[model samples]
Target chain A: METGTAAHDDAAREPVWTGLPPGLLKMRRLLLVVWLGLLTVVLGALLNLFAGPAWAAFALLPLALIVWGWVLLGRNWRSWRYAERADDLLISRGVLWHHETIVPYGRMQLVEVTSGPVERHFGLASVQLHTAAAATDATIPGLVPAEAERLRDRLTELGEARSAGL
Target chain B: MTTPGAEKDVPEAAEVVREQVPVVERRLHPVTPLRRAWAPVAVIIGWAVHDPNQAQEQLTRLTTITLLIGLAVFVPAAGLYGFLTWWFTHFSVTDTELRIRTGLLFRRTAHIRLERIQAVDVTQPLLARVAGVAKLKLDVVGTDKKDELAFLGEGEARALRAELLARAAGFAPETVHDVGEAPSQQLLHVPAGVLAVSLVLTGATWGSLAAALVVPPLLWLATHSVWTVLATALPLLGAAGASSVGRFVGEYDWTLGESPDGLRIDHGLLDRTHETVPPGRVQTVRIVEPLLWRRRGWVRVELDVAGSSNSVLVPVAPREIAESVVARVLPGVTVPPLPALSRPPRRAHWCVPLWWRGYGLAVTDTVFAARHGLLRRSLALVPHAKVQSVRLKQGPWERFWRLAEVHVDTGANGTVTARLRDAEEAAELLREQAERSRTGRRDARPDRWMA
Candidate 1:
């Protein structure tokens, strides 16, 4: 009931493609999680040696966290999608519960395209859109660098036309 | 429903009188002299009253000290007052605009277009009341600072409000009407029951009685003297109680009236204040019903204006009355139905089950009883917007679980928040909401003009 009949009218709306390209390297960013986990476990063991029993319990928390990260990596590897609409863009992800976010071109306050050192090696970039209200902003990570730049230019053009009362 | 044509009873052009131009009359603030002298005088008096046994020996020393302090205070007060009196006397108003020049050490001049004026507020302190002068504050939309013209005759305040209102209505020549006619409607006065309840809640009444009866006896028992703590403490308590009573008595006859120009609020005890706020300047309207007032169905209405936020137009009225006033003042904004008191979400309620999958992180909450303010049981939702920047947090134990915590930073003063919870359905919900908000349309609706 939440979705209107117009939602099913795919021809009237823009084309939506599920899943990111294989070349996108979002999986490499998972290393940051591994580095943080190693630091916590080392620090926890050091504290357990110096302090008493309470410190040992605190140190064991990081070991338990690494297992949680592995589960998320397995789930996200199967369930992420990116779609482009006529007036807006959407990024949908989630294995069990699905979530779809739409970002209209007109309301985009700022669009930033960034490439990290690791991402540059892989020729991938991330796009973030900022809005006046803190809520409802969007970020799409791991796209081909050239594609990211093209999307940014298109969004800027649409934003200017909307502000002029078009 | 009446047709638009039937409702249109336009008056003849000749009969419509033009609005009078507002004239700015300024004078020095009467309280400046008293405020400057109060500190020095209090210091001298305390010195003189101390050590009665050494009074004779320290007479010369005390006199020298008092004179030095008095001169230090008197010189600045005299210089400032002289400069203010000269600078403030030069305000003027034409048919189109108002201009004022004021300052002592740093000279400053300000100009405000009549068309952009949103509201005019007149405030009078205790000294101003005796001197028959009040401070006028004019608010304009989109401006950071308000135009202030301090110290004007009480009659001038009313005249200025009338002139400004008339100008806003676009009055024309060729028609003359009496300035004082029967007011279109009566002002709504604060109810007696609410006032009585407010007094009881203040706790000043009980404290006053306790000080008068119990303190003297307690002093007599402790130090074998009636005049020890009782003499000092009782008088201070009485003075504070009396002032509280005075304020209540002063605000007893508060009333707000709807006039052709805008909303006119008149209230005061020792120093009466008259305020006029036009419709256009209101940025946001908030209607609050504190948990305590739910049974009485009373609500407090506050309007966020451009210049003034503290001096909120607080109209304590019934819930329905508050809603209607808001609808009239701010059109187009949706007014959600009044939430029932009993139906508020409890811990682990039904909505939790549907949304729990999205909540990837463990949520810890601390609940306390609602205080006396408008909102009760505060709920902080750390969504994607709050994520100032996101960071992946992991612990040693989490490495085994293969789970990472997504820390989202929500910026201050905006709905964006930093959420530090386990990555689950909650994190997904936040990301989706943030994406949707980024594309939502910005608010640019035009405000309603009184004319």
Candidate 2:
């Protein structure tokens, strides 16, 4: 019974980490393919026309990188997770290297919800939290619009409730 | 923390504002024009210093005539412009704000709210000192730009600064009338000779001196050219010499004193700067001990003050004295010694192998301290209450070694960051630091400090 309670305590120490939705990964992969695919086609045609068809093999490099990046993007998306605790918010991201930023609710100066044209097309928005420190670049991207608004409102409320002097 | 009925009192506050008498607008001291226009006037004079009468070939008649005309037109124009600027600029202080009207054609007005003031600095440049006037610089929160009133009588500036600080602390302007120097006691003072010797012994100066000695010989051996050696040695020697001289002039007769208001720093030889660091505004305190200075048991203390540039608290002092100053600067906070700090595991050294041993972090009850540097050691201490945020970062190599860096950021630009600690410990530090910061902020003094 003591071990069971210890296990529960350990679990409580680690908050529930929420990963980004698969739609963001899909949208990013689509963007990568479109941009790199265009470059590959243009380069392949130019190499085939000017530098001989044998030189066209160089264009396949970008295509290969695209494939590698497609897989990497999914891993990166999976690695992007955030946790909300009683007093602060935690954001952890990156694949090869990791970064974790903890911004206490009281320290938050501004909470903004932003959606670009492309993100709006995908019905996605981002919530950016600004603390007094410029180094605290905590951004939660590619959430559904409704969830984004909810997060922004909730963060604003929490921030106001716990506001502190710099 | 607003009461529900506060909105109903808005009209009453408006009535109070309307009932208050208007403050009389004032202009800067008469010497302002001379102080403002001296730079351009000297520049023009320096440009015209080459006697046209002596240079036969270079100074053709047309060029000489043009030079004379240029000086004749520019000198008076600059002075007139300065006078015009001085005439147009007017300032007045109200109970709620300090307003300044400037610009000749555009007529710009700036209103600085009293509550937003972070610091009031009284500065006397060389020219201003000769003229017996000082400048008042207002460092306000929420903006990096400082609003300054140039060339006021020194006594007037001090009285105005006292009044401003009092008003910012929630006092009415009338209550602070006839304010004299804040009651202060001397905390520490670094002699000029110590400052000069410390500057000479700093790692940068010695490194440059070493480069001058070693590189020229090596270059002479390699190239068999005297000019190459001279070319390399002269600049290095000049740089080392100039840096020492500049630092000596700027930091001469450094003094730190404490008052109920805050810490006051008086320094500089040619330009005497009186900087008042209000209580609780210091974000971080750093103590630096260069390798050579370490032998002499001397260290430099610097402070990251909110809404102002980083300032040297003391140029050079003994280790104990520096520690005491730091303690005074940040009262009730403790800093752990290097050995008492938490260091990373052996494997974490793979990230920064040569400098790995230099990394250490300590969290006291109220302060978070980070120690780093090998040759020139530095210890940065930040009160937990001053922490704006905390971050943990890892690079690819650090990932391979499972090492991470934790950064505790304050509102100021400087950060107390510990590099190459165990990843798990760094994460734990981040979480615990946030909690400490929350509690620290909760316990910190309220915004209206004097009240």
Candidate 3:
């Protein structure tokens, strides 16, 4: 057959898109403010000591950038969402530039759930799906620990069920 | 190639019979140790020939008697080590899998399932060829490291390769004995003169040669110095020349042939290699036509197979020959012609000002094709069944132009990112490609390839 109708495009059958937990947003924003705030305060004090309070006002520039980045991160987080389908996984994200990757369940080689020291502190984890091709950049970030493990297990199970040879 | 009627009718029974055969463990040829030892010695002799006087002075400095004694002891020690390694390494083929046991102190066993084997390659280095032995490399699925059987008798290697392929294809063990050499018909042979000319005519060679010739003279004029010309230009010229010479020697006597087992490519002057690429295993095929070669209507064809990357199907051939070879390699697939390709919108030129017109995408029933590049134009065709994933990307500039790129990714070689399509069209292509991939996979040949 040269062409066929989209079998899985029905709106009723489409799965709900899952967005990252708001706790991740709070943790990330807190981290940004703490790091940038420390830098700005220290740099401003140094400038006040060496170059006067007038030069200390220059430190406000970084503070302004931090504020802008804080808002940008929220938008990027909102843009990041994933939806599991009958045979493939869809990950759509990006603010200025949009990217939507569809990795078939049959192609998944490994599914991993990882939590770094900071993420562990924040009680947040990320799920990564790897395929034979590196171009399938499928990573769902900032999920609750339980949700990440659940997703990993479910994906691993589905991957084994539909596993196809390369 | 005997396709026995019994096996064809009853694949299940054939599998049962195939699994019952157990081959005994076999060591490499006895000459393997000597060949391995001689390989390094040959390299040393070649190096010593370059600076014989320095070698002589170094020998004299060491005292000839002592040097002779050291060589006498060292040669035997290396030989013993090689012998030990050879003795420990053994390979056996079972009905279900091929097992290679290697290592001296710590034991290691590599088990490659018969059905998971993508290809079997036979390669012979100069020393191996001289010793009438060849190395067998098994390209197994799901493994980045290749399993190699080093230094088997040339004929035995071929026989073993054929036997393995036959079993992998689901033939009954009995019928496999009838498949001797698997008679292949020669499709094309590249002449030495043509290969040499093609190498010299490439844009890279021309640019490098121009640099070597012009840079030295320009420096001599600007600095009024002969030392600068000698110091900089000679090495650049030699390095540039060496690459072309190496390719020429490596790709000498290039031959493309077709056999029941797969498409066979035999090449190399010093280290001969015989590569078999099954049509089903090819992930993508790229046909490249450089600007210089366009007038001659010649193009280079390359295939990205499942386990191996960037395997050259033909060094250079007529466009028709390339097209036919590609069609042969990818059976039942039709590559859309260049003129029928869908080009990007004219206003999308803002992103790629010079080459926007060159970018094109074509989606056929079985293949997703992308055409791009101004100087070295290329058309890459990926069979939908071989597609691993689909991605749609739109950058800020592309967003400004309402353009997006649809990337069709294959297993290993690279992604085909067709850029500067309308945003909606790009999304549609991504969906269509993913859908096609699913359907293609369903209709593809089974993992038991021969069956």
DockQ each? 0.08, 0.66, 0.70
**Candidate closer to the true structure by lDDT (higher is better), 2 or 3:** 3
Q: Positional deviation of A64 in candidate 2, in angstroms?
A: 1.1
TM-score of chain A of 2: 0.90
Tens digits of per-residue lDDT, candidate 1, B275-360, equal 77665445344555545555677666655444553343443577777666655554443344424111212222233343322222
Ranked by DockQ, top first: 3, 2, 1
Which has the greatest lDDT?
A: 3
Largest DockQ belongs to which candidate? 3
Which regions of candidate 3 deviate over 4 angstroms? A1-9, A12-15, B1-23, B38-66, B141-146, B215-235
**Best model number under TM-score:** 3
In order, what lDDT does every prediction score?
0.52, 0.82, 0.83
Candidate 2 lDDT, tens digit per residue, B411-447?
8766789888888888888888887998788667666
Q: Give per-residue CA lDDT, model 3, range A1-166, as digits (tens).
A: 1112275467314656889899789988999999999999999999999999899999998799799989999999999999877677889999888999988888898998999999999999999998888777889989999999999988888788878757
Model 3 per-residue lDDT tens digits across residues B185-207: 98889899988888877878767
Evaluated at residue B303, the lDDT of candidate 3 is 81
Clashing residue pairs in candidate 3 (N, C-alpha, C atoms within 3 angstroms): none
